[model samples]
Target: MLYRGSCHCGKVAFEFKARLTGVVRCNCSICSRKGALLCAVPHESLTVLAWADDLSTYTFGNHAIAHRFCRTCGIHPFAEDVREGSERSAYINLNCVEGIDISVLSIFDFDGRSA
Candidate 1:
């Protein structure tokens, strides 16, 4: 299935193709604070549709993931694993996605705080 998403102000828009089996909820400090329901997709499957240059990034701890957000709205729409040696992946914030009811999806808990 193809999914479209964007930040609250629509400044950061993107789309991706995925047959989402489930979504993830992580307990790490940042993830916990953001309260995003994330769905992992291959980096290649994601396309930035608009205002790519306007997006802001945030990283912390090991700094493997680059959390991308809209500067104007402060909404984190997605994040990517940028560590050179790691398998590339984009974690899409399902809350930002359009035309879907997240309540129907199974959510897996990730103990990111311990990782």
Candidate 2:
């Protein structure tokens, strides 16, 4: 299935193709605070549909992920794995996806705080 998503203010928009089986809820500091339900996909599977330049990135700890958000609304839409020597991937915030019935999808807990 193809999904469309954007930040709260719609400044950052994107689309991706994926048959989502589940989403992960991470307990890491940022993830915990943002309350994002993330679905992982290969970076190549994602396409920025609009206002890509309006997006801002934040990184912490090992800096392996570039958390992307809308500067205008401060909504985290997705994050990208930027680690060298690793296959690129994107963690999409399912909360931002249109028409998704999140309650129907399996939710997995991730102990990211200890990772």
Looking at model 1, report the run of 10 residues with the lowest lDDT sum.
79-88
Clashing pairs in 2: none
Write candidate 1's Cα lDDT for 38-89 as tens digits: 9998898899887647798999998899999898999999999896644699
TM-score for each model:
0.94, 0.94
Residue range 1-115, candidate 2, lDDT tens digits: 8999998888799999999889999999999999999999989999987664788899999898999988889999999999665589999999999999999999999999999
Stretches of candidate 1 off by over 4 Å are none
lDDT against the true structure, each candidate: 0.92, 0.92
